[model samples]
Target: MMQAVIDRIVEGKHAVVLIGEDEVEKIVPIELISDNVNEGDWIEIKIDNDGNIISIEQDTQSTKGTKQRVKNKMELLRKRSKRNK
Candidate 1:
């Protein structure tokens, strides 16, 4: 199959999507898909006979977020950890 950029990946909450060309769409409960594959990366996906993502391959260049965003999330995680302690 021609490799398609993950136009979007919506997990949990019914878990279906209508993909558009050359645009952005929000994939919900992104964690589920992320857990199965890697979050924020283009994956080699295979649609099964049932039309589900039955397979995936990692594309390292597809990492999500600007450096600032990653830093902010790490900061938030650190703050939360400190609070838990």
Candidate 2:
């Protein structure tokens, strides 16, 4: 299993996924993933020896943590901008 985030859906057919700590982007056929998933949602994917995706599921806990981190960073940026202005 690998940790990934759904970055975006392209043309309604493929999903752009950012995988693991390195954030390597992989294009996935939308059908292989669960429908409840959306952009920025965290997911766990199971791949075979051939690098084929066999299973994927939404991971709520990771998503929440990631979102909180992003939100905090955005807030920090905003505060710095106010001081610079």
Best by the lDDT measure: 2
lDDT by residue for model 2 over 1-85, one digit each (tens)?
8999999999889999998899988899999888888999999988788877888988999999989999999999999999999
Error of 2 at 67 (Å): 1.0
lDDT score, candidate 2: 0.91
How well does candidate 1 match the true structure in TM-score terms? 0.32
Instruction: List runs of model 2 lying over 4 Å from the truth.
Output: none
The C-alpha RMSD of each candidate to the native structure, in angstroms, is: 8.8, 1.7
What does candidate 1's lDDT look like per residue over 34-59, in tens digits? 45443234544455666555554444
Best by TM-score: 2
**Candidate 1 — what's its lDDT?**
0.46
Q: For every model shown, what is its TM-score relative to the native structure?
A: 0.32, 0.82
* lDDT by candidate, in order shown: 0.46, 0.91
